[model samples]
Every structure is written in C-alpha cells, then in structure tokens.
Target chain A: MNQDILVKAIDVTKNYGHFRALDKVGLEVARGEVSCIIGPSGSGKSTLLRCINLLERMDGGAIWVNDELIGYRRDGNNLHEISDAEISRQRRRIGMVFQRFNLFPHKTALENIIEGPVQVLGEAVNEARERAMALLERVGLADKANHYPSELSGGQQQRVAIARAMGMRPDLILFDEPTSALDPELVSEVLDVMRNLAASGMTMIVVTHELGFARNVANTVTFMEAGKVVETGLASEVLSAPRSARTAEFIKAVHS
Target chain B: MTTASLTSSMSSTAETKYEIAHLRLVPKRHVGRMVAAAAVLVLLAALVRAFSVGQIEWSYVRDFLFAPAILDGLANTLLMTVAAMCLGIVLGVIVAIMRISGNPVLSSIAIGYVWIFRGAPALLQLMLWFNLALIFPTLGIPGLFEMRTVDVMTPFVAAVLGLGISQGAYTSEVVRSGLLSVDSGQYEAARTIGMTQMLMLRRIVLPQAMRVMVPPIGNEVIGMVKLTSLASVIQYSEILHNAQIIYFANTRVLELLLVASFWYLAVVSVLSIGQHYIERYFGRGSKSIRSSI
Candidate 1:
C-alpha cells in the first residue's frame, strides 16, 4: 500500500456462481497515471476495472481508494456492510464511463454533466451549469450541450459520458470499453478525449482493446488472461515487446 | 452513316420487343377469385336481409338515444369514467413504486393486488362491491368514528369503489411494465450523478416510462369507459341502463340497444383518435417509431 497509489486491490476475487470472474487479483494504480487493462472478452479486465469503483462487489479482497476501504467498514467485532447509499457516495470519488455511454437519455448533455455536481456535490444550479459548460467545451461538444444523448452520435455520446464523469471532479475515472460501441471511424474521437484527459494528469483505469491508444496514452499496461494478470509493466514493454508468452500471444492476436 | 444509325436503332427496338414478350403480367385467375369472393359476400348480405323478422322503430331509437334522461346518464357515465381514471392513475403510480420497492412486504402486497384484481372478472368485482353490505354491515375506523351500513354503501359509492379499485390493479401492472421498460442502467446513471430516488423517478424514470405506458393505458381508458356500462346492472342508471328502462317501457328493445351501441361507438371512436395522437407525441425520438416498426 504505497502512499502514492490512488487505488490498490489486494488479492481481489469475484465469483459468479461456479465461475470465478476475478481470481486473487492484485494491482495498484498510482496517482496521475493512465493505466489500461487489455484482455479478450471475459478475460476479467472489465470486471477488475469495475471492482476499483465498487460497481461490482468482490467476493473476497480489500479495495482501497486513497487508503479508504470500500464496500465494508468494521465497528468493534462486527463488520457492517456498506449500504448502497454509502457505496453511491464512495462511487462519486471514482467515476465510471460504461461501454454503452449510459448517459441519461432524458437529460441533455449539459444537464447530464451538471447532474452529479448539483445533486451529489450540492452545488447551486447556476454554478453546476457554468462548470458543465466548461467541461462540455473541453470535450468539444459545446454545440451539443442542449442535445440529448439520443441526438448525439455514439462518439459524441461517449464524450458526454466522459464529461459527465469529469463533472464530479473525481480523483480517478474508470472507463469500461468506452469506445467499443462506437463506429470504427468514430472510435478515434473518444480515444482523443481520453488521451487529452490523460495528458491533463487525470488518474484513469481504462479497459480497452485499442492497442494503439494504449501504446500512445497509457503510462502502464496490464495484460490480463483468464482472470489473472499475466503481465504488467511500462506500456512499451507490454505492448511493443512483452516478456510473457501469454502477452505475446495476446498482442499477436490483437494485431492480426 | 445515317443508314448505319437506322439499322442500329432497329436492332435495339427488336431486343426491347423480345423482352416485353417474355414478361408475365398479373394472372387472370387472381382477378376471377376476387370477383367470386365479392359475390359470396353479396349473397350473404341478401340472405340476411330476406330473413329480417321485425322492423326497428327509428323514432324509438331517436327518443331513447337523444332523450334528456339518457343524455344525463351518459354524463354520469363520463363522470364516473373520469373519476375512476384519475384515481386509477394515482393508485397505479403508488403500486408501481411498491412493486419495485426494496422492501419485500411492500412488493408482495403490490403483487397480491395485481394478482387478485386482474385474476377476477371485472363484472364479478362490481357485483361483490355492490353487495359488500353482506360482508361488512358496518366498516369502522378505530380511534376515529363510524357510519351506518346503508349510508356507507350507496350505489354511487359502490360503483366508484369497485371500478376505481379494479382499474387500479390493472393500471399498476401497466405502469410497472412501463417502468421496467426503461433500462436499469438509467437508474444507476442517475444515482451515480447523485439524484435522490424521488428526483430520479420524477425527472428520469416517469417521463421515459410514460412514453412507453401511454398507449396501453390509453387502451385501458377506453376499456374502462365501456366498463362503466356494467355499473348500470346494479341500478346505477348509466347510459345503457337508462336506455334499457326507456325501451322496455316502449317495447322497442332493438332500437334502444342500437341507441346504446351508437353512443359507445361515438365515445370509443373519439378515444381511439385521442390514443393515436398521444401515441404519436411519445413516438417522437423513439428509434422503433422512426423506423416504422
């Protein structure tokens, strides 16, 4: 548990019935670093990322964000499970962008961005609107502020999702296949937003198959296989010339 | 060169003629079948006309349908319908919430409500409420007060209670389906942004669910509008019952029944058109509607 680590998962394990989704997984994400988790579908990469934000509760393990254990608290001899409300409160510190964008369709882009700030942070509507406008501008969707998610293109919607997560001023943001749903031509726009966010020193845990983006923007790359972290190191080491045989196979499979 | 151009044009024209000769247009047999079907329908209509046993008194039809008493009955019918609808919608929202509530007891209660009312016939429910005096001579509120049995169970009271309660059950299921039609991810997204459950329901869930629920509930409204006629069986004197009384006195049963049918048709037609516009309003922005599914 290094003090520099913004998130640390110690031997985290998650089971869905007989199948283990995450198996004794341990990882650390340092502050102000972009870490990308790459694996095939059902390789537990997305599940691991979800665990960081307590979106998917672990069956066994301890998760700490800024050294605060999530999903549980001990009082005397009793370990009281955290309520959903409490979990929601903790989730505010770590925003998540879903694969489907999950933008509130009933809300306009500007409103979606401001919703967290106004509702969770208790900011005034005017102040929330101001910050939302600035974030929308940053995401290059200032013109689409009043547009609903249905009206926006998939890439634009993902950008709005990014802006919505950023609205909370979270310490770290988790992206679960953010650009996977976008058209091939539109993928780069969302990846560009992520790259910009990474450049701005935002701590991020991105689960993606976009090897090129991982090589360019990610500071660290962790390759997962069958619910285990098979390789972890600098992005170049993992992406360019991986030491592990599984990593090499995965990279080759991705390339071909 | 002009002679060569004329020969080339003649060759192209000959090719067009060959293609047209090979084309098969509509078959003559299909037209013959259509005419045979039309002739059968005409024969059936003629047979029905020949078997006419009695004449309908047009004057009796006019009197029963347009009389002031029957019109008043129609007004009462409308009033009962509107009141039941308002109550049903309000109850529906509550029950839908209960069904989705985290508390098991509340959810089960909602489930039981939908089960019992929807399981039973609406007519049976009306009869049961009309004869509720047999069940409870006096319904009392402890620490509050009580009223006489007859006073507490009037026909008007019975009709509203019966119809509204029954409608609520069906409406709840409709509303729940609407709410469930929305993605659970929407709720999660709203909560992640820190909106309270109340705010989320009001701003996010209900508006979206309403778009899904409007058509079904509009169908329910039309159904309930006709269902009000059943209340007349308990001597509530709705449009149909008033027509029955008038025609029985005049011995013009067919005319009176026709009069009632005409009114029902009129109301239903208006409501059907209303339902269309409402469906259209919510259909905007929906992908399925835009694609004409």
Candidate 2:
C-alpha cells in the first residue's frame, strides 16, 4: 500500500487453454523506478507486462496501477468488469511500446506521437504538435518527424515508438520486448533512449533480453521462468549473483 | 614487385581474358509479338470498316447524344448509383463489423444477411421489392400513419433498396477482408493509446485498411455504375430504360443501344481514372516500398 508504488501485481495468473502463460506472478514497480523482467522466450515475461496494461486479461487475481485496480471495479464482495470507456480512461495514464514498432503506417513520426493526445485526450492541435515535436527532439528524431515508419531505420522507428509512448504523458510505460525486433546495431540506439528516460525518473516495466540494459538502467530486476518469478532483487545483486540455478543458466545462455 | 602489385597485375590479366566490352549488343527480335500486333491491327481495321458501312445511322446517334430525356436518364442513373453506393457502404461497414463481432446473435444476423442477399439474383430482388405490396399491403407506423405499400415502394425506392442491400452483402465481405488485412498489433497499439474501439477503427485500423480496400471498393463502384442499368427492369428510368423507350418508338434499336454503350463506357472510364487517383491517395506510406520492389 505504499503511495510511491506505481504498479502492483498480486498472484497474477493467465492461461491459454491448458497452458498456463503466467502463474501466481507478483511484481511491484515504485514511482520513478525502472523494473526489467528478463527471461527466456515464452517464459511469460511479455505476458506479465501485457497483463499490467490489461492487453491480455488475467485469469486469476488482479493488477493495480497508481493504487487503482485495473480493468475491474470492486462492488461489495464482487469485482465487476468496468465499461470499455472506463478502461480506456484508466489506460490513458499507462503507455505501451511494442516490439514491432506498431506506428500508424499512414501517419508520420510527429503524427504518431500526437495521435493519442489529439484524439483520445482532446488536446489542442497546435499544443499537441508542439509537444510531439519536443518528443521527436527528445528521442533524437527531430528532423525525421515528417518521415513515415517505412521511411525510418529500425532504430529510428523504435525511438519514435518510445516518443509516442512518452507523448501520452503516462505515469508508467510498459515496454513489451521493445528492442527484440531491432537489428544488433539498432538495439543500442533504442537502449540509449531508454537509458535517458530512466535517468529522467520515468517509471517503466521493460520485458527484454538485454541484460546489459537491465544492469545499467533498471533499479530492480526480476528473473522469470515458466510463468513464475525465480528471483527479484537489486539489479546488481540479481545479475551478478543469481540465487536460482535456472536464472544463472539462462543468463549464461544469453551471454554465450 | 611487391605482393600487392603482383596480385593486381595477375587480376588485370584475368579480367582482360574475360572482357568483351567492345562487342556490339543486338536486341532480340520478337517475331511472335510483331505477328500478333499485325493480326490485331487487321482485325481492328475490319471491325471499323464493318461499323462504318453497317445499317447504324451516325446522325441519329449524334442527335440523341445530348437529348433531354437521355440527359435526365443519365442524371437519374448517376443519382441512383451514388445513393445506392452510400447506402451500401454504410450498411456494409455495419454488417462487416457485426460479422466480426464477438456476440453470436450479431454474427449470425450478419451471416444470414449476406447469405440471403448475396445468394439471390439481383433481378429477383428488384422484382420482389417492386411487388412488395403483395406481401404487405401497407407500410408505415402502425398507429400514427398509414400508406399503401405500392405508393411508398416506387421504382426509385425499390431499385435503391434492392441494389443497395445486395451491394451491401458483397461490400461487407470486401470490408471484412480489408479489416482482417490490418495487423493485430495495430489494434493493440490503438487500444493502449486510450482510443475507444470505434475511434481505433475509424482512425488507426480503417485508414490502414483503406489501402487494401480501395482497389476492390473501386471495382465495386464501377460494378455499381453498370448495375444501375438492372434497375430499368423495375422502370427506374436509368440510361438503358430511356434508350429502350426511344428504340421502341423509332425502331432504331442498334443506334440507341450504341449510344447507351458509349455513355456507359465513358462513365466507367472516368471512374477508372478516379479509382487510380484514390488508390494513390490511400497508398501513401506503402507505395514507395512496393514500387521499389
């Protein structure tokens, strides 16, 4: 119940028919803290991040952002599903950046950044455009604002995607493998931007394979395996000295 | 010589042995293509001679080109086409959305609508609408007002309803395919950005879907232009109907038919050009990448 906690998940469970994608997963992200969830592919790292934003509904338990339960409302003894409008209202403060850099292909970089502010929040066009331009500049893409997603390099597109997430003025941003789709050379550029964001005191939950980023930028690191968190501690403590054999093995494999 | 110089000299000798840059390049003759072209030209010339010498009177065709009745019919045809297409597109979007809805009842209703409308012949649908009075003698609010079905179901109404409803069925499939063509990631991105389902569809999904939809929708529009002539069966007074009436009186069937054909071709040609521009408009971001490939 700490007021500083931006995200709190308790016993979060998700299933894909017979296969449990996430099982009794619990995590906490304090305000202005970066938490990295690292695990092997299909180990529910991305699923945990998705469940936080209600992109994938949890089958059991709940998640809270900014002290308010997401996707549902408590009514006496029952938790009733909230209306889509209410869910959208709640989601307004929780931004998400995707691995594929799902920018509106029809829109330019500046337009993609301004879309949520202009359409969802109903901000003035000029105001939104001004802020969007600032975001473009912040991501080192000020000159590429007019370029479409196809016109951009993978690194540039991911930076624009990050700026798009920031443009909504989210209290927290969930990045679902944001750099997994990037080329090896492009990964560092996106990671650099994320590092700047972390330095700026933005709360973020990043599901990634980049242990180097986790070590440098993240305050807390959670190692997940088979839908369960294996270790959660300070980035240095967890990465340098993992308690779980699975975590160590996975880390060694990644390093190799 | 140093190793680099020795290697360069050896490579240059090897290159010169294979080099034939001074050879004259001769283009291959496409004998088959030339023969095909000559045959087509001869055929075209023969057809032109036959048309010129045929019993068709060019004077009547010229005189009737701008005739008031024909112009009125043209206007009516255009009006029907536009109105029916507007109705079709709106209904199609709704039906397509419903078809893909999670609710079983809505999906079933959409499936039934597509099945009934798309399966039946458009001609039969027009006849049924024209003669709807047989099934229901009156059509109006039950207690407030009453009007004869025959009066309400005029040729225009019947034709519009029949054509538009049938067009909607085909259009729904086109729209559904278009909607499906967009990546699932786009939907997730839109939702995360706090857009409502409708807003997401209107802005993110549909605009991207438009690139896939325009070509087929353009084909539908051109098809609709010609399909309006089918309404003539219900006395809708489209171009073909007016031409039929003239040919019936003057017995100048071929000339009048030719006039109608010319107009249809002209309208369709213009529409084709419009479709090209529209495709270009929707194909903004992806066009460059596609053309490069």
Specify the highest-TM-score model's number: 2
Could you tell me the lDDT of residue A147 within candidate 2?
92
DockQ of each: 0.36, 0.72
- lDDT of each residue in B1-293, candidate 1, tens digit only: 69999999999999888787667797566888899999999999898785464586677776666889878888888888898888888889999999999999999999999888878887788788888878677778966987766677777777887888889998998899999999987886776665667878887788889888998899999988899998888888889888888877877888888888898889989999998887766665565665774
What is the TM-score of each candidate's chain B when compared with the real chain B? 0.84, 0.90
Give the per-residue lDDT of model 2 (tens digit) for B51-111: 9999989999998988888888888999999999998999999999999989899999999
Place model 1 in a CAPRI quality band: acceptable
lDDT values, one for every candidate: 0.86, 0.93
For model 1, the local distance difference test gives 0.86
lDDT of 2 by residue, A43-146 (tens): 99989998887889999988999999999999999999999899899889999999999999999999999999999999999999999999999999999999
Best by lDDT: 2
Q: What is the interface root-mean-square deviation of candidate 1? A: 2.6
Structure candidate 2, residue pairs in collision: none
